[model samples]
Target chain A: MNAPAQPVLEVRNLSKSLGGKLILDDVSLTLNKGELKVLIGPSGGGKSTLLQCVHYLHRPDRGDVFLEGRSAAEMGRRNICAFRQEIGMIFQDFNLFDHLDAENNVAIALRKVKGLAKAAALARARAELDRVGLADKADLFPAQLSGGQKQRVSIARALAMDPKVMLLDEPTSALDPDLIGEVLNVVADLARGGMTMLMATHQIGFARRLTREIIFMENGRIIETGRPDDLLAPASESRAAAFCAKLTELLGH
Target chain B: MFDLAYYQTLWPRLFSGFWLSLSTIIPAALAGLAIGVVVGTVRGAMFPRFLVAPLNAYVSLFRGTALVVQLFVCYYGLPQLAMWLKPFFAARGLPELWRIFYLSPYAASVLIFALCSGAYHSEYIRGAILSIKKGQFAAARALGFTQAQTFWNIIVPQAARRAWPGCGNEIVYLIKYSSLAYIVTFKELTGTAMTLANSSFRYAETFFAAGLYYLFMTTLAAWIMRRLEKAYAVPGFGRG
Candidate 1:
């Protein structure tokens, strides 16, 4: 049979080192269009580093990341910006501009980058906030929001960009237990809605339920990759099974 | 020798001097802050690396030198330099007007003071810009903002709030440094007090009056800045 169609995002020998310590070492992956890929690994295994490289937040030290077949490393500033418009990345810290209220935070990129008029941006912001179930919180500053709410606002801000691909880096990790469910619910809804996403997370059950494919990483390398059930099934000998067992023990699951 | 009568006698002269000082201080401080915001934003945005380095060098040179030197340069040095280029300036028919504008000691002093303080203020502004979390810039970029749009729309306003306290300190220093303008013969509050004290031979009383004026001005400035800080601070966020 013919090889499956090329993925929407393709990595070829991508590598990065921070201060002479290898953070990502010769990592390669393919993300098919509309695929929900979960990257699960022990801490410092370079899952977030991989997402950041894809987001162009950190340039890979060696090799290439291609977005829709265009080399991200070769794109100039303007092209990079245009490429970024189509790819949204959420942070664990929820990096909202504190001076802006929730609505303005969402509206800013629309107004400044998209060149939308203020009224149009504001309307779009309101719509996105409503989607995140935060219509009433539009005027609230990030400082006023709980960790979960801030993360949701960050999600809305990303969604407002109308991105084709979204990368979430430990989206619920910073939230309190009571708040984690709220953010995870939002991500679940997005995944169910068929938004293309790459999420690095420790929420193993959520990963298994929400994602079609799961990739297990160790020491800056992909140790195993397969369908979620195939790798997570009781009879599996995949390294992912051992990794999940250890993670479950660590999380007291 | 302590005399309530001396204070009474000194009050009017001191009051007039205070008013003169404020006239120079307020306008120069306002102008300096505006220039600083522009320069700081430009430098922070890292526009045209060539331009940024030279602008940075200019800011550093002014901040590194004494304000007195800047005043002397603007007042005494500029005219000499202008005369050297008189052939070019006169051909353009701008030299005479420029000389007339600079001839007034008060105008030249205020101009120099504004330029000097603006340089230091820009440094504070740059520091504030740099202090913002890197993640904010990343988010802006991810949202499709160009470098310029990210700075003006997201960064500068946030940095302004962060930079306010430093800018307030600069404002207080500007007021105090207005006294230096007396050297250029501007006859502001300190200049008037000095001349009056010399003429009256009551140095202690006249100088005491000047001190009181400064105390009042500084107190008012501090109060206003505190209010500003409270207004701009994100509620529930730590002062960091």
Candidate 2:
């Protein structure tokens, strides 16, 4: 018999190339329920591409992604919209809809995709905004919000769907130094609340503090995978460990 | 001059001519707008090369040539074509059919106005659609909006708001150019002014009055556009 509880996400030999350059080369990873995984890498190392491919934002040239054992390839264009409901993605630039206010931003998917009525969507939107600590800022448009606040609202927008997994692509990379803490704090709370997440980020210190699985990538491949303590141990042993050590030292972990 | 006798006669003629202009321009502008939307949508979809090339050629054909020339072709040239089709009509026992091609100025003018103006409108609307950020498209899809839902609900509303200033300019252009109605023996604002000026030989007053009417109409249009731009402007986004 198939296992009653499959992994929340599973990938098999995913590969993607952009402009004839291999960005994600035959990569595979898995996540169980309540697991937090961090993808740490240099720029152009394919962390973002992997997340996007998993979400079908970019279709993989090869391999398959399974959400709870259902292959992404099996989903049609119509099916993809429905499939996306289970996954919430936050972007580096916090791609909130500029035309809508915070409440409408979160509520739109609920109303349009989930078929919730206006008042119900608004009510659900407000609850999620409250969860992200932006209950009062519901009326503000995306352009009116600060970088941190925009990210929190995006998180709220994602959380409002009650998704199974959240894909965060450099969630704090675009924020100012002082503003980074607030956005990371929200992610930490989601982690604590047991949200399954795959985050691509550079803040090694936050990854250290969160105690998640660390997957260090380089040149479109997963070079190392281990717990933070093992990867950031005192000795600059392996290439990944050496990289982690340098990053941790610079990041003041 | 505040001459009541002259005002009475001139007012009726100009008013009647203005009505003719309005009746002609409204339907023609609307037709133009409809054609523009379809053409613009095709352009924005970025279809396969074969299809897009022909659409590009159509836009260029209309845009590159002058409106007056296009109008003349539709009004005058069609009858010349009709002469050749006359033999086919006579053999088919549809003799009157060929004469129907002796197009009414009104029909010809409307077709000409719609086709000519629609070309420009498409460019305005297409530019507005293109200006929408790629992030917005990604964001909509990420939110689980189907492609159609995203276009109608998110993209179109924003693009329409952005396109308003140009659309307003087009409407004003329609009002001024409706004066060309007289070219086909249809008297509109300028036609009325010309007839009254030629008969009365009061060139200064008649033309000046007609010019004032245009100024008033354009000013009113400008004011409305300003309000629309203010109302529809995206909050704290694009514009400073």
Candidate 3:
């Protein structure tokens, strides 16, 4: 086997408190090159906070984010900005700029932050949208697109950044069941293409099929980490096993 | 009595005065709106906490005070302050500072009117900016937009578009209040009407004509505002 590549992302002892309540408690996680790690947890179990904190959106009160062996806090404004360009975040609500059409929404970051000329940035945006199978819908507004299509545009937007790590928070939660497959198929393709992804989701079937690393959380703490069979087997006693069993029963999967 | 005899001479004089009012009011409104955008963004963001209170006080002081009084002080009181500071300015080897005393009355009045208009505009703009969803800020930040970049590139344009209706109302006020330029002896529309009434003893005919003129100007102002709103409105966002 090839020796493991250096860790691409390291969250060291990250703790966050919001509204005087601890939302993240000394959580430490790492993402290696080309690894797909799934975070499965109950609602409000720090999954979203962990993702946001990694991007410095929540600004963890006590921890350092090391991206490619460089601490985020050590960087200046310009450096932190450049550093953020390497990490892409996708939201459940899709958060497309309402004022911009689909193509401009995907192209804005490239033009503004990356300083690409308008034509080049737009061409790249079109290419990414085509990759997500939304080339024809490029002119539609977010309000004009369906939940699934909006999510795909957002995914294409993140892809346009050429990020080294992609952080997705419940990418399928907002979609109708019929639309979930289309978005997941795109994500599954990304994973197969060797994109490093750390995602928080409750899609157990997809988690089982597309990834081997599952981290289950409850009450803002990871209770177990293992492969799907080891953690979700009917005979297992781990909290994760019981949780998945209950989900299966409730969801009738 | 409808004065047909005075129409030729009186109409020409009122037209010249209307030109003066237009020159001052148009620039004042544009400058005020620009200042409003900047101050409103700063006040609404309340970033750099130290400046927030001072900015609030500045806005309040202007919005609360009477514009007539503000104009009185700006026109009459500022000359005294400028006089008192003349030796101080001259001592610094900048005698060109006295050129302020030689400024056109319209320019001086525009300065005060612009600031007063800006205070009102800022309130409208602040409300518009605050009305935008917090998610816009969060999403932009997540996309790696710096605070300055998010504000200038994203927030300002959206807020300006939202502030359009309020700006239209303010501009109507601007057209009528521009007669105040006459108060400071600027010979604007109302001032010309006053001179015509004093000499001809036809206050009813002259002042009534001026009122119709104001109504016409305001109608034109509202029409332009409607066109501006249509031009800048974002598709599929706020139209509903």
Q: Which candidate number maximizes lDDT?
A: 3
Model 3 TM-score, all chains together: 0.91
lDDT pick, better of 2 and 3: 3
- Candidate 3, residues B1-240, lDDT tens digits: the string is 677777545666688888888888899999999888778878887668787778788889889998888888878877887788888888999765865764467877798788888988999999989987786777677777788878877787778778889988998998899898888899988998999899989887788778877888999999998888888766765663
Give lDDT tens digits, candidate 1, residues B29-110.
9998998988887787657988798878889888889888888887788788767776777888773655553456778877
Off by over 4 Å in 2: A1-6, A246-253, B1-8, B89-101, B237-240
Number of the top candidate by DockQ?
2
TM-score of chain B of 3: 0.90
What is candidate 1's CA lDDT for residue A231? 95
Residues B47-128, candidate 2: write the lDDT tens digits: 6788677777889998999878877888889999899999988888874677877878888878888887788888888888
Candidates sorted by lDDT, descending order?
A: 3, 1, 2
Clashes of 3: 0
Checking candidate 1 for backbone clashes, the offending pairs are none
Which stretches of candidate 1 lie above 4 Å from their native place?
A1-7, A17-22, A61-74, B1-20, B38-104, B202-233, B236-240
* Local accuracy by lDDT, each model: 0.86, 0.85, 0.86
Per-prediction share of native contacts kept: 0.77, 0.62, 0.45
Backbone clashes, candidate 2: 0
